[model samples]
Target: MSILKDKNILLGITAGIAAYKSAHVVRLFIKAGANVKVVMTPASKDFITPLTLSTLSKNPVYSSFTDEEDDNEVWNNHVDLGLWADVFVIAPATANTMAKMANGVCDNILLATYLSAKCPVYFAPAMDLDMYKHQSTKASFKKLTAYGNKLIPAGTGELASGLVGEGRMAEPEAIVKFIENDILVQLPLYGKRVLITAGPTYEALDPVRFIGNHSSGKMGFEIAKAASNLGAEVVLVTGPTHQKIENHLVAVKPVVSAEEMYKEVHKHFKSSHIAILSAAVADYRPKNVADQKIKKKDTTFTIELEKTKDILKSLGEIKTNQFLVGFALETNNELEHAKGKLKAKNLDLIVLNSLRDKGAGFGVSTNKVTFITANNTIIENELKSKANVAKDLMELILKQTHA
Candidate 1:
C-alpha cells in the first residue's frame, strides 16, 4: 500500500495560473489512497472552479468561513479544519498568498486554516520569473521555511506569460512522490518485528457449540495497524473476529481454539523484537468434547473442565531478547492485580484495562488504561479511542526498548 494510504490531506489552492494544475494534484492524492479536502482562495475560483475540485475530491471545497449565500448564522471553525488534517498542502502558491501566510494575514478561510494548522504545511510557489525572483518573494520563502513550512521548489519551464523561466509549479506527480518518500523513511519501527495476539479464542465443547468471550479483537487489530504505521513488520495471531486490517506489513494468522492461538503465537514469537499478548484465551476448556451434539434429554448436564496452557507465562520463561508486554483486564483490585501480573508473567510492561471505566471493556472502540512498568512505576491514561491508546502503547514500547 502507498505510504499516503489513510492519510488526511488538506489541499489549499491560491490564485495563480498554475492553480489549474491543482485539479491534477487532488486527483493524484486520491489515487495514492489519501482522503483529500480542498480549500481555495476566492480569487482562485476564477482559474479553477469549486465544482471541479469538489467533484475530484468528493468533498465540499471551502473558500469562505461560511456559506456565501447564508447569513452570519453559520460559521466554519478554522481550527477544526486545521486540526483535522494530517498534512496541509498549498499547491500553486501565489506571491500574494505567500506574503499573507508569512505576515499572519487571515482574512480568507484558506489563510486562517493555515494559521491554525497543527500539522506540517507544504507550499509550492508559482509565478512569473521576475516575480519569483523578487526580493519580497525571496523573503517570504525564507520566512515561511523558518516557520517550519516545507517549500517545494518551483520547476524551470515555460510560464503562462509566454516567457521561459524558473517559476513553474512542481508537477502533481512529483509533489506526491516527495511527500510519500519523506514520510515513509521516518517511521519509528521501520526495522522492527512485532508479534501480537488478539480476540477471544473459542474452545470447542461440541460441533454445534463452543466457549468464547466478549472480545471484538478491536484493540489487537488497532495495535497491529499502529505498529505497521510505525513501519514494523507485524504477525497478528487473531481468534475469531469480524475486524479486518489492510496494512501490507501485517500478516494475520487466524485461529479458533486457545491451543491454536498458542501454537500460532509461539511460531512467530521467537522472530519478533516485541511481543504483546492481548488475546482473551480461555482459562479452562471442556476436558472432553462430544463428536455429536448431546441431545436435550437430561434435566441437567455436566462437562469436566481443565486448565488451558499458559501462553504468556510460557513465553516469559523462554524469552531472550524480546520486549514482552501483556494485558490485564480487571474489575476489582485493578492496580494490585495488574502489578502482580506484570511481575508474574515476566513482562516488561503491562496495560491494565478496567471494566468499571465507562467507554472501556470488550467490543468497544474506546478504552481507559493504566500502564505498569517493569520497575513498578505506574502511568494512568484518560479514556481514548482504542487507536490512540494503541499509539500511546507503541510510544511506550519504543521508549522502553530504546532506553
Candidate 2:
C-alpha cells in the first residue's frame, strides 16, 4: 500500500522553462498511488500538451476554472475541483505563476485551484537563476510562506535559457520523498512535532442544526500541508465538513464538536514545536444541548448560551517555549482584536480576517488579510486568492522558525 493511497492530488503546471520536468513529477505522484488530476496554465501548454498530461494522469486535463467546453455535460466547477483533492502540487511553478500565486491574479485554472483549495499544496519553483533570484521572485516566495504553503527549493541544473545557478525544480524522487517525510504521519511526533487544529467547530443546539461559522478549513489545511512540505511532521485536528483527509501526507485526526476538538488538541499540543489554532472555533456553545431535534415552540424561541473553552489560553498556560498562532475573524475593529489575541494568547502572530471586506474571509475563493506579530508589526495586503494567501502565511511561519 502506498502512503498516497486513494488520495486526490491536483497537479498544477505553470508557465516555466522547466515545465518538461513536471511530467516526471506527475509520474512520481501516480506511482505513489494518488489519483492525479492536472490543471495547466495557458503558457504551460507551449512546453507540454494536455494530451501528454492526460495520458500520464489518466484524467482529462482542465485549463480554466470557468471554462465550459463544447459537448461537456458537466461544467467545470472550481469548488468541486477544490473539494476533490487531498493535495494540490504546483510543480515547476514559474516566477510569474508564483507571483500570481502570491498576488491573487486568477489568470488561469491552476491559479483558481490554488485559490479555492482546502487541502495541502506544494509549490515547487522552476525558473532561470537570474529571474528566480530577482527581488520580485523573492517577494513571491515570502508571500507563499506567509500563507503557510510549502516551498520546494529549486536546485541547480542546465537551464532552458543556457544560463543557470539555482533555479531548477527539485528532482521527482526528492519531491516525492519530501511528501513522504513531511506529510505522512510518523512516530516523529512522539518525540517532536507541530500540532494544528483546523476547520469549523460546531456548537450544537439540536440534532439537526448547530451554531457554526464557515471555516471550510482551507487556510488551516494549507498550513498543515505547508508544514508537511517543509519536513515538519504534522498532526491536523479538524472538525466536521464534507472534507476528508485520507491517506494524507500527515496524520489527520478528525473530530466534530468543540468538546471533541478540545480533547483532541489538548492531547497532542504538548508535543508540538508550534501550534496554529486556526479553526473557526465557536465562541459560545448552547448551554444545554438537545439530544433530539428541538421542536419550534413559537415564532421566536430563546436559548441560553455558554462560553467555549479558551483553547488558546489553556495551551498558552502549559505551552512552554512551543510556538502558538491564532486566527481572528472580525466584523469590525479587525486589527485591534487580532492584536489583542496575539498578546493574550501568547501567540507569536495572529492572522486577521475582516468580514467587512469583499472577496475575503469565509466560504469564498479569495481572501484579504492582515498579519500581526506579537511586536505589533502590521502587514496589510490586498484582496487575493486563498492559495496565494496560503503562501503568504507560510512565509511568516518560516520567519518564526528562523527567529
Candidate 3:
C-alpha cells in the first residue's frame, strides 16, 4: 500500500499551461487511497474547469472565497480548508503564484489557504525555461524553500512555448512518489527493521487436529500495522488467523506449528533492530505423531507430550543489541511473572495481560495491558482497542530506545 493511503491531500492549482496535468495528479492521489480536495486560483478555471476536478475528487472544488448558489453567497473558509489537510501540494505553480507565495500575497483563495496552512507544503514549478531561470523566479524558489516549503524541481521537457528544457511540472506518478518518500524519511522508525510474531502457534497431533489456543493474533497484527505506519520495515511471522493487513513495509510469513514460527522468527531476528514476540506458542507438543487420524476406540486415551522450543528465551540469550520484547499472559501474580519473564528472557520490555480482565485477550477487539520495563518500571494502561494498545507500546519502545 502507498504511504499516502488514508491521508487528506489538498491540491492547489494555478493558471499555467501545465495546470492541465493537475487532473492526473488528483486521479493518482485518489488511486493511492488519499482523500483529495482541490483549491484553484480563479483564473486557473480558464485552463481547467473546477467541475472536472470536483468530479474526480468527489469533493467540491474551491476557487473563490464566496460562491453564488440560488442567489445566496456561501463563504468558503480558507482557514478550515488549510487545517483539514494533512498535506498540501501545489502543482503547476505558475511564476505569478510562486512570487505571490514568497511575498505573502493572499489575493486568491488558494493563496489564502496556503498562507494559513500549518502542514508541509510542496510546490511543483511550471513555466517557460526563460521565466524559470529569471532572477526573480530564482529568488522566489530560494525564499519559499527557506520558509520550509518543499520544492519539487521542475523536470526537463517541452514547454507550451515549444522550447525543451526544465520548468515542466513533474509527472503525476513522480510527484506522488516524491511526497511518499519525503513523508517516510521524516518518520521516527525510518530505516529500522522490526521482527514481530503473532497469533497462536498450533502443535500438530494429527492431520485433522492440533493443539492451539484461542489467540486471534489481533494484538500482534495491530502492532505490525502500527510499526509499519511509523516507517519501520516489519517482518510479521504469524500463525493461522483471519487477520489481514496490506502495507508495503510489512512482509508477512505464514506458519502453522510452533517450530515453524520459531525458525521464521530466528531467520529475521539477527538482522532486526527490534524483535517483538507476541505469538501464543504451545509449550508442549505430542512426542509421537500419528500418520493417520486416530479413530476413537475407547472412552479414554493418552498421548505423550514434550516441551517445545522457547523462542523468546532463546533470542534473549543470544541477543546482542536488539531491543527484545515479550508477552506474558498470567492469571495470578501477573506483575511478578511478567517481571520475572522480562529478566529471565533478558527482554528489554514485557507486556502483561491477565485473562481475568474482561474485554481483553483473544478474539476481542480491546485489550488491557501493563508494560514492565527491564528496570522494573510498571505502567498500567486502561482497557483500550488493540490498535491503541499497539500504538502505546510503540511509544514506550521509542522512548526507551531513544533514551
Candidate 4:
C-alpha cells in the first residue's frame, strides 16, 4: 500500500505550459487514495481551467487569497491549508515561482502556504532547457534543497518550445513514485537494515504432532511493520503463525523449529545493524523423535526432553557492532531475571513482559513491557496494543542506534 494513502496532499501549480499536466497529477494523487487540494497561481488559470483541476481533485481550487467573484467577502486561510497538509507538492513550478519560494517572496496564496508549511515540501521544475541550466535556477535548486525541500528533477523530453532537453516536469506516475520513495528515505531508519525474529517455534514429536506455544506472532509482525514504515529494510525470521506483512521493505523467512530460526537469524545478522529477537522459541524438544505418530494408549505417558540451543545467547556471544535486543517473558522477579538475561546473553537491550499482568504475554494483542538497557537504564511502558508497543520499541531503537 502507498504511504500516501489517507494523506492530505496540498498541490501548488504555477503558470507554465506544463500547468496542463497538473490535472493528471491531481488525478494520480486521488487514485492513490490521497485527499488532494489544488492551489494555483493566478496566471496558471490561463493554461488550465480551475474547473478542470477542481473536478479532478474533488476540491475547490484556490488562486488568490479571496474569491474574485465576491468583493473580497470571503477569506482563504493559507496558514490553515499549510498546517492541514501531510505533504506539500508544487508541480510544474515555474522558474519565477521557484525564485519567489527560494527568496521568501509570498505574493500568492501558494507562496504563502509554502512559507507557512511545516510538512515536507517537494517541487518539480518545468521550464525550457536553457532556463533550467541557468546559474540563477541552479542556485534556487540548491537553496530549496538546503532548506530541506525535496526536488523532483525534471525529465529530458520535448518542451513547449521547439527544443527538447531536461526541462519537462516529471510524469504524474514518476512524481508519485518519487514522493513515496523520498518520504521513506528521509526517515531516521532509512538506511539501516533490521533483523527480527517472531512467533513460536514448533518442536515436532511426529509428522502429525508438534509442541508449540500460544504465541500468535502478532508482536513480531507489528515490529516488522513498524520498522519497515520507518524506512528500515527488515528481515523477518518467523516461526509458524498466520501473521502477514504487506510492506515491501520486509522480507519474510519462515521457520518451524528453533534450529531453523537460528540459521535464518545468523544468515542475516552480519548485515543487520539491529537484531530484535521476539520469537518464543521452545526451551526443550523431544530427545528422540518417533518414526510415526504414537497412538494414545497408556494413562500416564511421558516423552524425554532435551534443552534447545539458546539462539539469543548465541547471537549475543558473537555480537560485534550489531545492537542485540531480546525479549524475556517472566512470571516472577521479571525485572531481575530480565536484567540477568540481558547481561548473560550480552544483549544491548532486553524487553521484559510479565505473564502475571493481564492483557500481556502470549497470543493477546496488547502488551505491557519494561525496557532494560545495557547501561542499567530502565523505561516502563503502560499497556498498549502490540502495534503501539512496536512503535515505542522502534523509537527506542532509533534513539539508541542513531540510524
Candidate 5:
C-alpha cells in the first residue's frame, strides 16, 4: 500500500544540516517500489556525498546545471529531468532554498530544475526552531504554497541547534505515508477492480526459440502502480521482470504466454472495472510446433502461421460495465490503424506508438503517444518519460472512470 511503488519520484536535498536524513527518505521510497533519483545541492554535498545517495537510489546523482562527465559534454538533461518526475520532493529544505523558491532564484542546478518542473512539487522544511517561527520564513512558505507547491509540514521536536521546540524535519516513514495517504484519498477508481496485462508473451514456435518482443513489463507495471495510487485494487498479470512489485496491495499473477495471459486476465478481468492490455502478445503463432529443437541453420525454412485469440475482442463481447483499452504499434499509418483497432475491438481508448519516434515503442525508457478514444478523438503529446506517460494515461482513465 506504499504510495511510492513504481513511481518516478525525484528527491531534492538542500544544504541544511538535516540533509543527513535524506538517506532514510531514499530508502523508504525504494522500499515502496519507487525508482528513486536524487539531486543534491552543493551545500548538501557537504552533508552527504553523491556516491552515498546514488548507491541508495541506484540512479545517477544530478547536481550541476551544466555539469557533464562524458567526452561529448552531453550533460544530464535537466529539461528531461524536469519533465520526467511524477512528483518532485525537496527534503530537508533550508531557508535559503525556501527563499529561493519564493523569489524564483535559479542559482543552482537543483533550484533551476525546480523552476522548470511541470509536476507537483513538495517541500519538507527544516531549520532552527526560532528561525522556523520567524515571520519572514512563514511568509516565504505561504507564498510558495500559494504558487501551487505543497508543504509536507515539518515536525515539532528537538532541533539541531540544541533548542527543543519546532523545525524538525518529518521522518522518512511519515513522509512516505503522507504521499501514499494523499494519493489514496483521491483514487478515482476507488473500489473498482483493475486488470492489466504486461510484458512479452512467448509464443513458442519450437522448444529452442519463440516469437517475442523485448517488453520487460516496465510500462505495464507502471500502469498498475498508477491505478493503485489512484485507489483501484489492481491485478497485475506480468510475463517477467527483475524489478520487484512495489505495492503489495495489488495482487500479482505471473504468466508466460498469450494463452496463459488470457486465462489469468479473463479470470480476474470478469470483475475488473477497467482493463489495459499492454502485453505484446503474439498476433501469430506456429500452426504446429516441434517437440525437440530444430537443429541446423537452414537459410530457407518456413513455419505455418496461425492467429492467436484476440483477447480484447473476446473480452469486449463479454464486457458489461468495464472499460476496455487496447495498444497499437505501427510503422506506418499509425493513427488510422490505431483508430481502426479502437472501433473494431470496442475499446474505450487505444494508445498508439510508432517506431519512428526515438524514445517510444519497444525497449525504451521514454515514450511518445497519441491517445485515441472510441469517438476517433485524439490527444497527442511530445516525448516524455514512461513514468509521466503512465501518469497521463491514468488521469485520462480517471476522468472517464469518475464520469
Candidate 6:
C-alpha cells in the first residue's frame, strides 16, 4: 500500500495555467487511498471548475469564505479546514500567490487556510521561465523554504507562453511520490527491518487432528501493522490463524508447527534490527506421527511426546546487535516467572500477561501487560485493545533501541 493511505490531504489550487492539472492531483491522491479536500483561489475557477473537483474528491470544494444556499450564507471556517488536514499541498501556486504567502497575505480563503495550517505545507510553482527566474520569485522560494514549507521543484517543459523551461508544475504522479518519500524518511523506523512471530503453532499427530492453542494471532498481527506504519520492513512468521493483513511493508510467512516457525524466524533474524517472538508455540509434539488418521480402535489412546526446539532462546543465544523480545503468559507468580524468563532466555525485554487479570490472555481482544526489562526494571500498563498494546510495545522498543 502507498504510505499516503488514510492520510487527509488538503489540496490548494491557484490561478495559473497549470491549475488544470490540479484535477489529476486530486484523482491521484484519492486513488492512493487518501481523503482529499480542495481549496481554490476564486480566479482558479476559470481554469478548473469547483464542480469537477468536488465530484472527484467527494467533498465540497471551498473557494470563498461563504457559500450561498437557498439565499442563506453558510460560513466556511478556514481554521477548521487547516486543522483537519494532515498535509497541505498547493499545486500550480501562481507567482501572485507565492509572493503573498511569503509576505503574510491572507486575502483569499485558500491563503487564510494556508496561514492557519499547522501541518507541513508543500508548494509547486507554475509560471513562465522569465517570471520563475525573477528576483522577487526567487526571494519567495527562499523565504517560504526558510519558513519550513517544502518545495516541489517545477519541471522543465513547455510553458503556457510557448517557451520550454523549468516553470511547469510537477506531474500528478511525481507530486504524490515526492510527498510519500518525504513522509517516510522522517519516520523513526525508516530503513529498519523487524522480524516478528505470531499465532499458535500446530503440532500434528495425524492427518485428521493436531494440537494448538486459542491464540488468535491478533496481538502479533497488530504489532506487524504498527511496525510497518512506522516505516520498518517486516517479516512476520505466523502459524495457523484466520488473521489477515494488507501492508506492502510486511511479508507473511505461514508455518504449521513449532519446528517450521523456528526455521522461518531464523532465516530473517540475522539481518533484522529487532525481533519480537510472540507465538504460542507448543512445548512438546508427538514423538511418532501416523501416516494417516488414527482410528479409535481402542477406548483409550496414548502417544509419546518430545520437547520442541525453543525458538526464543535460540535467537537470544545467537543475537548480535539485535534487540530480542519475548512474551510470557503465566497463571501464577507472573512477575517472578516473567523476570526469570527475561534473563534466562537472554531477552532484552519480556511482556508478561497474567491469566489472573480479566480481559487478558488468549482469544481476547484486550490485554493487560507488564513490561520487564533485562535490567529488572518493571513497567505496568492498563488494559487496552490489542492495537494500542502493539503501539505501546513499539514505543518502548523505540526508546530502548534509540531508533
Which of candidates 3 and 4 reaches a greater TM-score? 3
Q: What would the per-residue lDDT of candidate 6 be over residues 254-278, giving only the tens digit for each residue?
A: 9999999999999999999999999
**Model 5 reaches what TM-score against the true structure?**
0.59
Model 1 lDDT tens row, 1-403 = 5678889999999999999999999999998799999999999999999999999999989998888877764787789899999999999899999999999998899999999999989999999999999999999999999999999989999999999999899999988977876676678887789999999999999999998899999999999988888888899999999999876789999999999988998899899999999888999999999999978988998989999999999999999999999999999999999999988889999999999999999999999999999998899999999999999999999999982
lDDT per model vs. reference? 0.93, 0.81, 0.94, 0.93, 0.86, 0.95
For candidate 1, the per-residue lDDT at 206 reads 93
Model 5 stretches with alpha carbons more than 4 Å out: 4-186, 297-299
Q: Of models 1 and 5, which has the larger TM-score?
A: 1
Return the TM-score for each candidate structure: 0.70, 0.56, 0.97, 0.87, 0.59, 0.94
Stretches of model 1 off by over 4 angstroms after superposition:
1-8, 12-21, 27-48, 58-86, 90-178, 331-333, 356-359, 382-385
Model 3 alpha-carbon drift over 4 Å, by segment: none
lDDT score for residue 378 of model 2: 91
TM-score of 1: 0.70
Q: What CA RMSD would candidate 6 show?
A: 1.9
User: Whole-model lDDT, candidate 1?
Assistant: 0.93
lDDT of 4 by residue, 1-403 (tens): 4667689999999999998889999998898789999999999999999999989999999999998889755999999999999999999899999999999998999999999999999999999999999999999999999999999999999989979999999998999999999888778888889999999999999888898999999999999988888888999999999998776688999999998888889899989999999999999998888889889999998989999999999999898999999999999999899999999999999999999999999888999999999998999999999999999999998888777
Candidate 5, residue 351: Cα displacement in angstroms equals 0.9
Strongest candidate by TM-score: 3
Worst 10 residues of 4 by lDDT: 1-10
lDDT for 318 (candidate 1) = 94
Q: What is the lDDT of residue 252 in candidate 5?
A: 87
lDDT of 3 by residue, 195-269 (tens): 999999888888998888999999999999889888999999999999999888999999999899989988999
RMSD for each of the candidates: 5.5, 14.8, 1.3, 3.1, 8.9, 1.9
Candidate 5, position 353, lDDT:
86
